[model samples]
Target: MSESVAPVSRRGFLAGATALGAPAPAVPAVAQPRAGIVILIDRNDPHVMGHAISYSGNLSRYFTGKGQAVPPIEVVANGLGIDVFRADKSPLKEPLATLRQMIPTVVFSMCASSKSIAESRENLTIQLIDGARLVPFGIGRMVELQRKGWAYVHG
Candidate 1:
């Protein structure tokens, strides 16, 4: 009886070699924690945006000092606050631009109802980031955030 040698498939050998030669996929070393925070801004009030920005700055500095990660902060702006989010014509343009640069992690939630009012009454272009999550009402959003385990500080 003659012993026969098994034939190895070229494709299978090449695939195994390629897989072994490749380096392990690189992973990000920093870990991000899930922190939820809600900040309510009274847009109808003339002083709200200034206060909110100041509060945000303080909160960010506090978190940095503590050596702990800050939660995602959402600033819900309605009524007059929406003015900050308005297209080029906003009076708070310079302030908003500055705030945006400083707090890149903050989410600015503009009220859709206010946008509708702007469209009908003033023909204002409410420039918002695409597909932002809408709360039933700006106040409702504040309540919702509080109920959903988010820390709330009204400024």
Candidate 2:
């Protein structure tokens, strides 16, 4: 008995060749420790301020899950962004305060220069929200954080 050889179509040959030549699917490298993140906020809008605070809290929740170390999350506010940090002027006082207490790792920072400018303009002392720290300059502080391997995010 003679065995018949099947004829291969051009399309079938090319498809097989392509499949054989395809590279293996890429996979993520070994699990890496969560890195720190810096969130920059420069607008004076209440919505923007609230969004930044909420985003920081979300990041904190994600990084701190599974008993992982609480990576640093710095919310740096500059220019008019200082308005949100103003204790008396900010509308998000309640929510921001709650976030501060719930996630201490998510720190809020306002620019001293911006505070001075706002104070000069308003002719009054700008009291920052409780626990809000002041940086010498927002951009400068961001640069320092970036140099230290903290990822930068704009809010």
Candidate 1 to truth, TM: 0.64
Model 2 lDDT per residue over 1-155, tens place: 99998988866766776799965445469755456889988998878888888888777777668667767888899998888878888888899888878877678899999999888988999888888999999999999888777899888
Clash pairs of candidate 1?
A: 43-81
Provide the clashing-pair count of each candidate structure.
1, 0
Please give, for residues 70-92, the per-residue lDDT of candidate 1 as tens digits: 66778887776666555644555
Q: Give the TM-score (vs. native) of candidate 2.
A: 0.73
What's the lDDT for residue 138 in model 2?
Answer: 93
lDDT of 2: 0.84
Cα RMSD of all models vs. native, in order, equals: 12.7, 11.7
- lDDT at residue 31 of model 2 (Cα atoms): 58
